[model samples]
Target: MQLLILMVVLLALTTFGFRLGRGRAIAASGNNPRLLHSLPRYHGYYVALWSGLPALFLIAAWLMLEPSLLHSAVMSALPADLQGLSEERLALVYNEVRNVARYGHVPSTDAVGQAAAGYIGVRDTVFLSVAALALALAVAGLAFARKRIEVELRARNRVESVVKVFLVLASLAAIFTTIGIVLSLLFESLRFFQAVSIFEFLFGTQWSPQMAIRSDQVGSSGAFGAIPLFTGTLLISGIAMLVAVPLGLLSAIYMSEYAAPKFRSVVKPLLEILAGIPTVVYGFFAALTVAPFFREIGASMGLSVASESALAAGMVMGIMIIPFVSSLSDDVITAVPNSLREGSYGLGATKSETIKQVVLPAALPGIVGGVLLAVSRAIGETMIVVMAAGLAANLTANPLEAVTTVTTQIVTLLVGDQEFDSPKTLAAFALGLVLFTVTLALNVVALSIVNKYREKYD
Candidate 1:
């Protein structure tokens, strides 16, 4: 609550500074914005940045350091026996203190109660001091900016430089985060490959990853074959793409080239609403409705179909992905130059011929991008496949058989408390590494196609 109040106060001060700076700039220009070096708004933004940025930096730094400072202060006052406890025990004690201080929990001991009280007091004092210092910094910044605001001040350039630096920092943060993920995956996958052969994981057919706890137990050497998982993933994703591409592309063509304006607006939003629906809901639909329906149909035809089949999951996943393809393809087709269509028509072509030969060709790049994006979504999906398709990593091309994808296995492997050093847990990372590589490859292929075949227009 104190932090919230401090933030609100800082916001009010920043807003006030903006208005004051703009008013001062106008007054300095003899009540004429035209005489100023930059717009009055830029001066306002300059003052706002000055008022907020330093205090924001201070608040961020204080928040980051506050926990450690409080911990050190409290630990220094702890009893020798408590201080001498193991790291794990000390962590538990610290957690107890925090709970007592923050959540009004009953402390188990007098030392804990006293430590919690001191923790609260120190935290409150530090927060109050930081809040005061932040406000002072904000006020100082506002005063400095107010003095610097003049007819000749280049507020726009300074503000834009700050924004450019912020953008660079944000980009670097994202790049570093991606690098961290790739390195973590690479390290864990290398560990997994040490325990299990990469060749067997890649090419072996059997994939029962249940490891016996004891050496004397049966099935002690768990099979680590990933071909079944890969095959199942491909089968489901391929089935989904087969169902999605035709429907999504044809809908895009109809909406972009043939539908009336009112009808198009109404129908487009309705179609896109499919994208907004939660995948869990689609999973439910697939499991409870679509799967059973397919099973009954197969039974009536004297054919066998698993209750949890790839066909059921893939079909529902395709339905969920329809909006991705339709929306992008519609935008790309609509953006095609009208001159191309007109030229096609002038050369004795019909409307359908003009669209098929000119507009579609021009829009192919975006359509391929959209389709590949949908394929990636299909591959990455977990909840729908988990609920609809059984976790039987059957290496089969028949969509009527039960199957599982890499993402489903990754989730299953990681759930619950398990030793990370075990092959079972590490297998998830190997699966993730493969999934990431496949997605990256798809993106590279999509980019290559877009760059090579894209039609240039005026």
Candidate 2:
């Protein structure tokens, strides 16, 4: 809490110092307006950047490195016999240490608890010392920079350059985070591929993931074929798109082209409420309502349907995505130039015809973008499938049968007690990589289509 408060105080002080520096620079230049380089706000921004950025960078770097350093030190202090433990076992020990340090009570041996408490004390002392030093340096630097503000400082241009650098850093952070995730997934998937052949995982129909814990265990060589999971995911996604696209597009068309202002104002918000509905709630709705309904309907039609069917989950997911597609499509449709509609109307086209022929084509790119966004949402959906799509990985395309998706398998694989290094558990990472690749490819294709459509208009 003290650290948080210190950070907040630092931010406020930095902002105040920047404003003061800018004001001072502006006042000093009042006698010679032509000598000023840039706006007063820019000058202020420059000072704030210098005051906060370096200290923040130092703090971030220290925080990241400190944890690993502390962990390594604690591990080294452990008995020599314990030091030879596997990485997973070491992680368990670390977790116990963390718990003991946090609660001041050991769930295990008293000696271990004492060791944890000692480690925690040392870690906290070191962290606080470093933080204090950093804070003091930041304060001294801020004061020095504030004293340097003057008419000839070119503070505004300097500030603008700093702002640009900050923006670029922010973007780089996001890109780096994405790259990190991909690399982690790739390495884990590579581990999984070593255990199970890529061809078998990609094309084989069976997906029994119960592997041997011991060398003597029977039926331990579990097949890692991923065909069924992929099929189930595709089936569910297809069903969801079928339910979402037409309804969302029609709603968007009505709202953009025909609805009165009063009706649209009321309806648009109501439509968006679907997006606000918690996905867990949608999950239960799929499990309790849609699944049972489908089963009953299938019975009436003399066809077999599992109690937990893909159709139920997919349909609910589609309903959840409708607002996403409709709202985005409506915005793009409304943005279409008025001249196109007018020309169509002059050619004896009705309102519906003008919208269908002129507005929709003009807005096709953005609408495709919206639909692709919805597709990504569908692919990544978890809760609805977990509840309504049963854990049977059926390779068949029949949506009525019980089938499992990649997300469902990943959840099941990681949910309970498991060994992360085992083929069974690491399979989740491989599935995740495949899922990521598929979604990325879909996005690329969708964006390409949207860009081409946009180019036509341009």
> Which candidate tops TM-score?
1
Clashing pairs in 1: none
TM-score of predicted model 1? Answer: 0.97
Q: Which residue runs does candidate 1 get wrong by more than 4 Å? A: 213-218, 451-455
Model 2: colliding residue pairs: 46-159
- Number of the top candidate by lDDT? 1
Please estimate how well model 1 matches the true structure, expressed as its whole-model Cα lDDT. 0.92
lDDT of 2 by residue, 1-458 (tens): 65687689779878887877677777878856567776666667767776787678777887888888878777877776667899998788877887788776644865467669768877888878877876776677677777777766777667767778879999999999999999999999999999889999999888989876676654369878889998899899999999999999999999988899999999999999999999999999999998999999999999999998888888999999999889989988887888899999999999988887889878988898889978988998999999889898788888888889999999999998887798999999999999899889878877887677667665
Q: How many backbone clashes does candidate 1 have?
A: 0
Identify the runs in model 2 with alpha carbons over 4 angstroms from their true place.
31-35, 68-101, 106-128, 212-220, 300-303
What does the lDDT read for residue 370 in candidate 2? 83
